[model samples]
Target: MAETVGDYVLQRLREWGVQQVFAYPGDGINGIVTAFGRAGDDPHFIQARHEEMSAFQAVGYAKFSGRVGVCMATSGPGAIHLLNGLYDAKLDHVPVVAIVGQTERSAMGGAYQQEVDLQALFKDVAGDYLVEVNVPEQLPNAIDRAFRTAMSRRAPTAVIIPSDVQEEAYTPPAHAFKQVPSSPPGLTRPAAVPSAPDLRRAAEVINAGSRVAILVGQGARAAAAEVQQVAEATGAGVAKALLGKDVLSDDLPYVTGVIGLLGTRPSYELMRDCDTLLIVGSNFPYSQFLPEFGKARAVQIDLDGSMIGMRYPTEVNLVGDAAATLRALLPLLTGTPAKAWREKIEAGVAGWWRTMEQQSMVNADPVNPMRVVWELSERIPHDAIVTADSGSAANWYARLLRVRGEIRGSLSGTLASMGPAVPYAIGAKFAHPDRPAVAITGDGAMQMNGMAELLTIARYAHRWADPRCVVCVLHNNDLNQVTWELRAMGGAPKFEESQQLPDVSYADIARAMGLDAITVRSPDELGPAWDRALGAGRPTVIDVYCDPEVPPIPPHVTLEQASSRLRAVLKGDPGGLHLVVQGAKTKLREVLPGQDR
Candidate 1:
């Protein structure tokens, strides 16, 4: 039975549960595209503009959906274009499987059109590359291996499906590889405990502590309930790094707060006041900001023994998982809790938490970006997936958002990047078009990549599905934040870049591209504009002209950079005179502020 190699590739992906492949069709890959269109059974190919955007969009889908995100490109240049996104996904630890069309197998050494060593080109970017000449029989094995490697290592895998092989076939033998769902861990722990006396010694130390604090990390997320139980037994206050936010309910009274650079200073101060700081599950990077050994005794716990003392110096190091360690230590704990020490620590935490929260509030009426995003967050539908592009907008999102229910944070689980949010929103829409997906992009970041992807929504709506996507642009007229940053860095004023951006208009550009565009310059117009845009329900762009400086540098950042940047903006080249006008304009604006436009 002769079958097209393209058909075999489709069946292999179907077996592996790949429902969508984000792509930009090219003549070199027409056979596969046609085969994909006919596969039916609810599988669909999403067409993207540049193959680069397609790759990035696929990476996002892979990361959030925990599925093998598939992308495809034609041979040579098309395949070359996917490298950036492939590398991005690789570095970000995402599972992406890229399928690049290749020159006919027989044309390899003849310098064929659009032919090159595609495998060598993508070697570094992909964790694994499979150049399969035959489909049907060989393709399934390669697809299985690609998914296994990608799922385990979270790196991209690229498959080279040469053109001529598309028409070849091999009937499947009676036996086929069956797919299975990943199951949760059950019953007993993997590692055993130490001597009973050692466990007793650890528990004794923990029980005698007058004030106890548990610092939660990713490991804690794995056994959050167990960690919570330990905290409940000791009545210790809990603090966590960014990754552990949703591990324990944020609204829990016993949960002190987040502890890190972007977190409240009170948490750090509270840790200093405590007699014991138990580092659980995470080796958070900022040890200097943590309470010093002189201020409090530090104890570290981890599933991997070596991770202890790798970051901060620890007085006690436990070589078991956070949950196991806590369970073992419970029995050894002795002595009644000290009333005075606990009360003083609790008082400090209470006072500090209150003051820190007060600092988060903003009342500026071309409302400060902090207040704006906060209010905007309140308005978003619960379960909405929000992606934030970098720069001032991202900074604000990190500070202002409150995850009350289920949500995907812009920079939560991975190293944050710019230009991802816009394209990511497109992928999110494709993943769950029924739900609201909003991309909050800064003017600078949007201009960096937004021009290339605005029509993805249109393509899906007019070309694939009816559009229900939202693209929100935080349209600050200039790179005001960058200008301020350069002044702080002792570099030449970046105003040269800022002054040049004033003429750019996203609303005009979105309208030009056939998207519903609305520019909201004032707080009063924001709500109504958003409502109208949401109601219109196509690919809509709401350009909110926000004040760039409204994102006040958090306390963690030193003002030294801000001060130096101000001087650089003033004296760097002939911008001295311009800074004077800008500074004065800034002051006048304070007295009688105009629209950010």
Candidate 2:
């Protein structure tokens, strides 16, 4: 049989090394789904419970695998459902390609059933690359460009394929739609390298500074060693943005932990005190946490020229790939080792972790959330692909989990959304089936997406060669992060009735889905339960009941924020006073010393 337009699309995906696609089917996309069904084992179509999950799974796949993530949806609502997850990809700068099934071309303008203006709807989210296949012959090139644009830009791309066009027989093009470039369609061009003059300028700025600091972001993830070398040569201390948490080890003497609200005190101190700041690949948004404008001479290195100095004033903008730029700039500079700065960062980080350890070890009436994260972090395999949902769970994992060598993971950092943990784990497992994958999620986020997606894991759990997937649900029975935020903002606990979840057995739900599952109510049970989950060598869910009152406190607290907490407590909010007393008694002891009652 001659190939169909749908067949060409699937073939292009396979040619580009996309082995799996997360999808949810509807009438509008029946043709493409049928084509995917026929394509067989190469590009296995994973049927997710919702289109949102399909998109999130794709995001997770791309993050862990370093390849373009692909997801598909039917027209109208199905396509609309993909926006949230696609936005997650866009904001996080992950490469994801979304294929939306449009109505038949003849029916599009008539406002027919399930006819959504896919282009119009996706403009803001997938505007970087959004195209609807107008002709059957355009499918191949469109597919190729969509993938290439997504990969090169590290953003979400959408292709709207009409069902009628998908069903049409594919024919060789009469002539090219546009001139074919010399390089292959899906291959990305090399990142720009900095000019000698730019490199020399950046080098001069750094060499002239007495105290230097480097702030790394997701852009510098591949340039960890280069960042370390630059920091070492310049006598600089390193502070990573939250997205770049795994780029370097927290144990590095010159490395401070994350910067910003979820950051460490040492990191904040570094940014405040540095005389010169070298920003590589991180357009970190929190300018308030950055060095004061006039206090520091700044230089930035980025592959994207537009983002080079968008976040801060730059004295020297070195527009190039982070590692390459640093390598080139290294030889031009007269480097001096700032032993004083490095030692200061090391001591601060040490003291901070010591305080964190004390807080994490406190025994609450229910299991402390920090303890759960700490135990899981300690037990997971070094190579495990860990994912955190955006909530208190992300905060705990950020503060407590020490990602050493080869422990790669991701969070919904930029979108700051919840419910991605489950799909992320499933996708990570598919990408690296031989390795273990873990998802640390909260009760609210777990119910939102993970609860349904757990069944998706069950359906394909055996397909993976050596599946060892773990979903650890921190069942605090409340939207703890939001509740804390309300208290932090001087508002009473108004969301408790709305945000507090019913005490349902997540472990029971997992068992019903035919997976090994357990619920832990005490700290002692935490370790054994984790051991069982990891050792099961199959998909497992461990529901650990955590203390909902514990706060995900930031490294620094302003007087206004402290006053808000006090106001909330004075207003008779249930957990506010308890949280304050707990902080005073346990968390503040190491830091406040004599002030702790």
Candidate 3:
């Protein structure tokens, strides 16, 4: 039997070492679906409930596996649904390759059903590389380039194939005029390091300072050991960008936790007090949270030259792989250890953890959201892969959850989009079937997409060696994050019509899907509930009723923000009194006796 272009597509993906392709089926992709059947699932087809979830699952797989993620969809609506997740990958700088089926070539310009101009649609999201394989001969080069560009640029790339082309007999590029040939699929990335002169200059900036602070991001994950060595050599406090939360363990005494709006007081103080700054593999966008310009001499090292020195005014910018560059610069650092500065930072970090504990114990309507994550922190498996959705839940995950040991954690850092927590966990399961994966999500996100993805978990749970996939839903019955954003950022009262969420029993729904389920309405139930879920032989959904009025306060609040909340209360905000009480109690933890603040 002659190989069809669709069969060749899967063959090429296999050659590129893709073990699974996250996808959904449709009539437009019938040819490829048929090829999957003929190929006997050599590269497994992981069907997602929707095209968007498929893309997110790929992102999750790529992020955790440190490989290129591939996702597929049919034309038009299926293609359009993939945009958000692809954007999430692009913004978060994850490598993903998207394959989509297009309408038949004859129907493309005729406006046939499901025929949309895919080239223009994908141009921006997959701007690094976008190609339409109009002929069987174009398949090899097109698919190869998509994977290569995705990896080289760390961005989403796309390859579009018309239905007719996918069904045509496959043909390799001829050794003739007008033919373009591609080499076999393989990528060998070089370890790039800055020049010796540049490394010395950066080291000089570090060695001259009496107090140093290092900021690490997702880019620094590979350079964890180098980052620690540099921190020790310079007596620096290390602050992690939210995306790099797992880059270094929170157990390190000099680690100041996450740095940004959703950060700790110690991290804030680390930036405020540092005389010099070393930014590694992080392009953390919030400059306001950093030291005041000119107060600290800064040096930045990143793999991408374009992103270097954009977030701060740096004295030196070294474009290289973080680990390689940091290793080269470490020996040149000759500063005397700032013992006093190190002790101050460590003390602040200690005090901040105490504050977090105190804050978690504060009273609320049913349960404080912080306590939910705090409980998880106490019991999270050392090797767990944790993911958090964007919402008020992210606030708790950022502050309360302490990532330690081999625990890997991530979320939509740049996109900050909702509804990827469960799908990410699903991807994590596929990435490492032997490890336990946990997801922390808000009620709003669960209702958006997490509920449907639970069935995906139930479907694949048996394949995992360790089937402890836990989805912890913060059931607050409100769009809590945006509701608080309206009050704190816009001085607007919470309009119940838009902020309120329909109450649903997520645990009951999970139970219906044949997974273990638990419900917690009291703080006392959190620890035990987590234990049961983490020990479960299959996937589990934990629905905890959290307080909607508990504000996600930042490490430092401006006077204007305080006034805005006051105005919101004066303007008859819903839950105004409860908001004030919870906010006060939560914030009081920072200023209490023994706290650094």
Provide C-alpha RMSD values for all models, in order.
Answer: 6.3, 2.0, 1.4
Q: Give a tens-digit lDDT track for model 1, residues 440-465.
A: 77777677777668867656655324
Lowest summed lDDT window (length 10), candidate 2 = 176-185
TM values, all candidates: 0.76, 0.96, 0.99
Summarize candidate 2's per-residue lDDT along 90-124 as a digit string, tens digits: 99999999999989988868979988888899999
lDDT of each: 0.66, 0.85, 0.93
**In candidate 3, how many Å is residue 257 off?**
0.7
Question: Which candidate, 2 or 3, has the higher TM-score?
Answer: 3
Which 10 successive residues of model 3 have the least lDDT summed? 588-597
**lDDT tens per residue, model 3, 1-597:** 899999999999999999999999998788898999999986899999999999999999999999999999999999999999999999999999999999999887997999899999998999999999998888699999999989989999999999998899999999989888999998888999988888889888899999999999999999999999999999999999999999999999999999988999899999999999999999999999999999999999899998888988999999999998888888898889899999999999998898888888888889999999999999999999999999998888888899899999999999999999999999999999999999999999999999999989999888889999999999999999999999999999999999999998998999999999999999999999999999977899999999998889999999999999999999999899999988988888877844432
Task: After the best TM-score superposition of candidate 3, give how far the Cα of residue 228 lies from its true spot, in angstroms.
Answer: 0.2
Best by lDDT: 3
Colliding pairs, model 1? 5-166, 486-565, 487-564, 487-565, 487-566, 488-561, 488-564, 488-565
Pick out the ten consecutive residues of candidate 1 with the lowest summed lDDT. 179-188
Order of candidate numbers by TM-score, starting with the best: 3, 2, 1
